[model samples]
Target: MTTLQPDILIAGAGIAGATVAAGLRGRGYSVVHLEASTQPLDTARGDHLGPRVVETLANWDILDAFFAAGAEKRLGAKWLTPEGVVIMHSSIDDLPLPYPFYVVLNHDLIATTALDLAVTAADYDYTLFRPVAARDISTGADAHGGVTEVSITTPEGEAVTIKPRMTIACDGRSSKIRAACDFQIAHTYDYEKPFVVLFGPRGELQDPRNEINSYMSLNGGVSRIPRIGGQWKIGLAIDKQDIGRWKSTTSDERKALLAERAPALGEMETEVAGFYPVIRRESDYWTKGTTVLLGDACHTIHPARGQGMNFGIRCAARLFDFLPDPTEMSDAALVAQRLADYEAAVKPLTDAQLSENHERGLHMDCTGPERMQAEIPTLRAVAADPDANFRYRMTMAGYPDRLDPK
Candidate 1:
């Protein structure tokens, strides 16, 4: 093991960074994980790990532990009109995939759990530095004109330098390494803001057979997803400009708004879980010299489909498939090519996915009687149509475009 410097430095211990770290280290690569936050993680965002992601977890052999830690398995989801009519229901129960269901777990827990396992695995060479951030960064040159040295400061104000083979920026959209390095982004800014998340007990709808239910109407759109231990996680897609008005509302007032928006799902406990912004931010390139961007650092899609982290996991898996042998790390060109390959494989597919999701979010934000009349019927027809509905379920299951030719 190169104790003085690891082969790879993974910035940000969220889903993407942690997944890649655990993944590469399991294959016996040396990795150093850096995370900025010391406080307990709020693992509430994007709990739905679609069938593809669940299969990835199973391949990593971490699914069992995830379930043990209270992750729920869901076969599909249902889209409903506010009056409780099912507009569309997507299922994966019959798929031949390893896990024909979405795995619902706290994102923070999955990352931490995977990290914990990687750290303790008997043969994996993985080190973790939490509550530490990249205070300063610079690329150090090597004989081959590659960036070979990277530096950071620990939480105790100690300076440390790493001659890593590669540095991965998995930090979220606001990535420190990304900012310090200034990776150019090609953004598709869809609608933003007024997105709210509510978490509490199983409000009113609680059933083992029930898939995720997204109720929509002229008022707004709210999705209620079931969780393990009889809890619930819900998301709201609303007008971007009304975010301030939302923030000023009381819990009771907020609950009332959800009632008006989602409707018919029954009442939640009026406890605020969390709020997040939904934005579409995609980077122009995935690699620069020896550094690579993964997850939100590379691309961020709207949360309407609950596919943000799943897409990141997909990036991790594909990148894992394309990773170079540790001995080949000295070839900067080769590293950049590999990152490019991963990006090439993932970006087109994810770009399409994000665009479709953005359109879906737009459809979900309808707030007028006329728009509702136009939307509900259109949704019903599409849901009834074989090809489109198949695509819908396939997308929800994380395997978009899996329809058999008719």
Candidate 2:
């Protein structure tokens, strides 16, 4: 086995991992990024990047490239009844934010674009190993003892040992690195509503404002988001028992099912993408020793609010804030300390958002008046209260840190 040592090791090349890899490389950090999948990077989740993510893109010098790659901008979002009656509408146009619009693009496009831009950095000195899987992870002492070493296998059937100052696990919900490090989940909430994703040509619905229109009722909910290239991405909420029926359904049958469950989206012809479980959970700890967890590896939230990718991107940015120029630091202990500091500064925000998301998810996927009864009053009250509305807009727009209530 060949042994390699790098300043940092990032396991996974999804949006979260790519964001961290690109951002760190732009800052002159030496990193080794590993991706277990030999297939091209394509995911069904996280197409909507909240507004604040643009700041990080700009900082990494990829803002123009990001938009140039067919990303669409959305000014705001609306809550409506399935019959097209608006219940609540929130706009970011008046917010005090660096960017006033969220972006919509394919999840794969974002991940690949970020990594592609990272290599173009003048001081880029990182290695990306694709089809490389971390087979073994050994943590010394305790969770705080950090990782002593990781054994990875490459596509070429060669074995390599990696020792790093720090290791970040961004490998999604079932992270091998997180499991190997023995991090336990302290809080978890499995949302009763499950959603199936769909994408198709923009129907007769005229969206001059380019906003996310979410239709909710006793039958269910349909969140219609505009995609680049004049298409629409739909998230159709369904009951838990329907998950099995959805899986066994044919494309045409799926259409009929949509019509029955979410009438607002059923009329539009769209292809079924896949099912995404709505589960909100967080690990008991984010960092141990020189090891850290990020994105879905540490915390996951409901997609109803569209904050999963946004929060992950912000976590990467916040981690960079707590870290020094890698060249200025080489001590493993110091790296561990920075990891602890990063978790300290970011976890509280994540916990609060996850809790709120859990509550909101409960009101979705209803088949009766309970959903309306639970949601209408809350939505109307928020809209009636300017301060509450402003805060809501800020949080939903990906500016939780800047929520200054008047």
Candidate 3:
């Protein structure tokens, strides 16, 4: 029905995409963001933002909006034993960062709020193609060896070609653009089990120690995150094979299952909200000429630590850091260099985070009937050791293992 071209094209309007679009608009760059789903993809996922993202939000001048979106302050991480005894907790309260608190806000809120802020930004030039998807891509062989144009299909069965200086694929793990384009997945670590999250009201679940809690027993573990509306998010680790069986669980069956595994989580009267598979995958090269991968597109990791979305936001920040001056436009070389510079600064950090997450998933993803009970004492000791505790708090506080931009 209509045609539009912009300086930058973003696929997927999730937190990462919206952050990139919003941050760039503040830098006076025109952007186009595409969303495949007709409505916002609201899932009970990525609700925790560590201090890094909290600081990043403030830097982008959207911290107020993020807080206004109704977020519960996550004081720190707490790991509980089967009997609900606190085994370990490293309070991030003392972290020397600008934001020392982790805010638990739902994806829909932060993401939609991000888009809203982008819309009201000074001189915002953005176009949204909802319920549309990129079906194919055309690439050029010259300066940026980047995508020339992407053919997207509208909901009404119309195809349109839009060209952009840079196309950012922020479409999560199953990025259609990354699939259609020439990006290569250099490394992939797929879990035998995916992280499954079930949501229900904060009914009668005993909350005497009502903190963001990880309830682990000998019979697999579940994490309970308190949401804005007295709702609790139940996170489960389901093996890859049992994915369908778990997804097909009935409403009552879900409650029963929740009561069985995470009895402390009260009852889950509602059906499963979402089941997300955990995988750590990164492209060999995030930027190829004019096209660059952002967010989960570049590094899709397990929810071991709460750094997935934070990492994606960092990517957007680095892109904001390296965006070329508007007047430097037609110099394909300049655009290519900017793209490459962002990637150069971001990819190494992503690699380290991805590797670190892989290890965390292996140790923390103990879903067997027998909990990692035996390792609890050792872990408790580590939590008690002054140096080890500092290190743990530092890492758990969202400190980057490597801060080098190279």
Over 4 Å off, model 2: 41-43, 141-144, 202-208, 247-266, 365-367
Candidate with the larger lDDT of 1 and 3: 3
Off by over 4 Å in 3: 1-5, 152-160, 202-210, 240-271, 369-375, 401-406
TM-score of each: 0.90, 0.92, 0.87
Q: Can you tell me which runs of candidate 1 are displaced by over 4 Å?
A: 1-3, 140-147, 155-157, 188-192, 202-205, 239-255, 364-366, 369-371
Ranking, TM-score, top scorer first: 2, 1, 3
Screening candidate 2 with a backbone cut-off below 3 angstroms (N, C-alpha, C), the clashing residue pairs are 144-289, 146-289, 146-290
- Mind giving the per-residue lDDT tens digits that candidate 2 earns over 1-406? 8998887889998889887877775566778889888665545677888778887878877678778988778788898876778889898777888788877778888888888866566677788888787768888853357777888877778888988777889998888888888889887787777888877665444665578887766666667787776777778777788888877877677677666645766667777678877786688999988888888888877776777778788888888888756775467777778888888888887788778776666656454677767778899899899989998898887777777754
By TM-score, how accurate is candidate 3? 0.87
lDDT of 1 by residue, 1-406 (tens): 1233676888888888877766675576788888888765576676778888888888887888788887877877777887788987666786656577778777778887877777788787787877877655666444122235556666667677867677888988887676666677687675644467777665354677547887866676678777666777777766677767776877677777877866664555655666676677878777676677888887877776677788888878878887788777666678777877777787788788877877866655555577667767877887789777776667677776566633
Give the local distance difference test score of model 1.
0.73
Model 3: per-residue Cα lDDT over 291-400, one tens digit each: 88888887788887778888888667777778788667556778888888887777786687678788878765667754466666767997788777777776665665
Model 2, TM vs. native: 0.92
Arrange candidates by lDDT, descending: 2, 3, 1
